[model samples]
Target: MCGIVGAIGSRNIVPVLTEGLKRLEYRGYDSCGVAVLKDGALQRARSTSRVAELQEQVQADGLGANLGIAHTRWATHGAPAVHNAHPHFSHGPGAEAPNTKPGHIALVHNGIIENHEELRAELQALGYLFLSQTDTEVIAHLVDHLYEGDLFAAVKAATLRLTGAYAIAVFCAHEPQRVVGARHGSPLVMGVGGVDAGERFLASDAMALAGVTDQIVYLEEGDVVDLQPGRHWIEQAQAGEGGAVAHVRISEAQRPVRTVTAHSGAVELGPYRHYMQKEIFEQPRAIADTLEGVEAITPTLFGTQAEQVFSQIDRVLILACGTSYYSGSTAKYWLESIAKIPCNVEIASEYRYRDSVPDARTLVVTISQSGETADTIAALKHARSLGMEHTLTICNVATSAMVRECKLAYVTRAGVEIGVASTKAFTTQLAGLFLLTLTLAKLRGHLNAEAEASYLKQLRHLPAALQAVLALEPQVVAWAEAFARKDNALFLGRGLHYPIGLEGALKLKEISYIHAEAYPAGELKHGPLALVTAEMPVVVVAPNDVLLEKLKSNMQEVKARGGELYVCADGDTHIHAEPGIHVIRMPEHYGALSPILHVVPLQLLAYHTACAKGTDVDKPRNLAKSVTVE
Candidate 1:
């Protein structure tokens, strides 16, 4: 995953580009750089650290320009070093120039170039000198090789020669007022700052342009855009016979610009120590906003065609990855038990590569916080190719690629989640999925009027329930104190809570750098019990359901292994504290909505544990908030 931001304006654009990089930092990056056309030459600054360090380097060197491209790279083809940082340049047929010298082309790229080996060899044979071990550098050299006159034409021709996903922003020293960009299999969007403002912008996500511009144009696959001061144009590329390069034709395309109110203020770390902590505490309001104005559950709540789509579906196929995959797993239990619909959840990255039965009548639901997840979008397309065309998405971003690809969508109002480890987004997705389950149950005549009324009341009370759960943070913090001293964690749950346990383990490992694993309580004797010792901390999600007795039996098994148990249990579970056993009583026992409540304490546990361990709670190592590249 990476981020790109470009601006062509009259005023000095250094601050705009750097601030855009700061906004996109949540996507995760190992290195950052900016290339700008200053005084008819390319001026660049790069750092193998945070964007703040890059900004310092820029200020110390007095780097400023009217037109520029910036990038935050999550290393894919190269190591996280200064040479591999983006804003790579090429000098064309001339001798290689110094870093501060005039350059023919400067480029920033987001996705992988799959055919770079061959391309690099060919460019090298043509006498182009390479500077960095990145596929992105090859693109910049290719653009320089093709540059006869126009930067836009050279970028278009370069895209025709490339094979793989990319969202690139390029600028030429000769064209001081222009920046060209193109995308294929990755996301790119244009921002309009109005005619009077005299600026046009490009970014991988609209959030990068927050507070600068509200208007956005989402570029489709194979679209190339030319951005100049106060003006822009888009061209769509159509493949010829067998998708050959010789016959590729370009035609002008009209992409509608929509006004999106970017939440700039939401990115601020208000009173919380970290974005993760703030997001965890915001779950109550997030769930409330996701469920607002829902007096009753109906098929149309998803979309206008949801009623027709729900009536035609016989089963459900959930596609997602990461935390979204866990949310989908939890929904499978709800859809099968409550709605009487057979449901199967698949990891998006693996689903497309494996053979599976794809029925046309099956409803395909995708879940993602950012709609731009590359694997999920590709999997959705793969399912559609196999005749599973009835598609729906539960995502946070309204303008994300997932929403555009799906026929129906339930947009979660989680605001902007800056933390790499998801908190509010996961809860909001569960809220949306539960609504879908209720709607399907009603459609199948499984939910009577009284049942619907009762479920609606429970849905309305979720905010208050989540609020009560957050009150247990102080208790969770106490448990975290004991957990901070350990290096390993084991989470145990039964039935629906099993996925919740998995999520808890994921949170702990992602932010705290602890090696954590989760298993169904009954699976302890199968293999995991052998790893249990006094050094291992066991977390049990013990809701007062039918599985409580069985879960208690599992807790006894852990106790017999000399393991310390940290349990989040209901007040009336009758499970009390004993030697090697610690219990944090939950506020109340929510029947169908128990998973939503149980997950909050686990999140708080991970948050406080990471805090005690002094790990980076927002940007976890080697993890990107949005997985844009597969």
Candidate 2:
């Protein structure tokens, strides 16, 4: 995943481009660069560090222009290096000579170019020298080769030869007043701003355009956009006889401009030390917002056509990745048990490649925090191709591609989650999924009036319940102090809380860099028990449920092996603090909703552990907030 931002404005656009990159840095931060058209040539600055370093480089060099394109890379095709940084330059034909500067075209791209090798060979044969080790360099050269005095036409023609997902923004040194952008699979949004101030912008996410503009146009697949001072137009690629992009025509389809509130205030760390901690603490508000105004359970809560779609489908198929997958796994338990519906959860990346039985009557549900996860989006498209047209998305961003692609959507009001390690987004997704479960159960006549009323009351009390759970952070911090010394951890849970254990393990590994794994308590003897020792720290999600007795036996197994146990147990569980067992009592027992409350302590544990380890809790290492590429 990478971030792309481009601007064509009256004033100096260097600050605008740099500011935009700062907002999108969570999407990528490996390396950053900017290229601006100035003095009838391209002026460029690149850094192997974060966007801040690139901004400093730009300032030191005194580089500024009215039109520019910038990128923060996630390093897919090449290592994180200045040479591999974006704003890649194409020196044009016969530019193999040394000391060629400002050659012709400068481009910033997001997504993989599958046919790059063949295109590189062809371009090199035509005397076009590539200066970098990026597939994006080939695209720059291709555009240079196809330049027929029109940058838009060149980009359109370049896409015809490309065979992969990409969202590209290109600017020609000769055509210094405009920037042309096109997206095939990756995301690109057009910001229509500066009508009075005379500016136009393009970015990978609308959050990047916050404060600068609220008028946003989400670009569709195969849509090519031309942005210039105060004006823009869009064109869609027309498929030829072979289903390849033959030509481009003026877009007749509607791409509405929607007003999205600025998220600049939400991303601020405020009093919290890190975004992860802030988000972890924000779970109460996030869950409340997600369930807000839900006075009753109705299929229309998801969408206007949700009742029709839900009635037609007999089963539920969930596609997601990482933490979202865990949320889906938890929902599978709820959907099957409470809704009386068969549910299957599939890892989005794996599901896209494997062929399986697809039922037309099955409702395909996709879960994502950013809603721009490349693999999940591809999997959704794959499911649609198999004739499962009934699609729904549980996502945070209403403007995300997943929401646009799906027929029905329940947009979780989780706000902007800036941390690379997810917290509030995961909880909000669970809230949304639980609501979906209730809606389906009501439609199936499995939920009576009393049961519905009880569920609704529980849903309304989630905010207060989460607030109580968050107060256990102090106890979790003490556990983190002990856990910070351990190199590995084992987590155990049963039934629905098993997925919570998986999420807990994921969080520890993701931010704290601890090698952690989770298994059902019963499965410990099957294999994971062999790893337990005096130094091993086993964390258990021991809620006071039917499985509590079975989980206690598993704790005894760990204790017999001299393993230290860190347990997050319910208040009434009677699992007290023993010599080797440290129990952090939960404030209350929240039946089917216990997983939601149980996860907070794990999040706090991960946050404090990562803080103790002195790791980057907000950004983490080798990970981005959104997975925009496969």
Model 1 deviation from native, Cα RMSD in Å: 1.8
lDDT of 1 by residue, 1-630 (tens): 599999988888888889999999988899999989888888899999998999999999999988999999999988999999989988455456354344589999988899999999998888788878999999999999999889999999999989989999999988888999999999999998843467899999998888889989999998889998877888878756796644233433458888898876247677889989999999999999999989888888899999999989999999999999999999999999999999999999999999998799999999999999999999999999999989999999999999999999999999999999999999999999999999999999889999899989998999999998898888899998988999999999999999999999999999999999999999999999999999999999999999899999999999998999999999999999988999999999989889999999999999999999998889888989999998
lDDT against the true structure, each candidate: 0.91, 0.91
Clashing pairs in 2: none
Model 1 residue 449 distance off true place after TM-score fit, in angstroms? 0.8
Q: What TM value does model 2 have? A: 0.98
Q: lDDT tens string, model 2, 443-467?
A: 9999999999999999899999999
Tell how far residue 273 is off in model 2, in angstroms. 0.4
- Once fitted onto the true fold, the runs of candidate 2 whose alpha carbons sit more than 4 angstroms away are 96-98, 195-197, 242-244, 251-253
Q: What shift in Å separates residue 403 of candidate 1 from its native position after superposition? A: 0.5
Candidate 1 off by > 4 Å: 91-102, 194-197, 241-253
Error of 1 at 5 (Å): 0.6
Q: Whose TM-score is greatest here?
A: 2
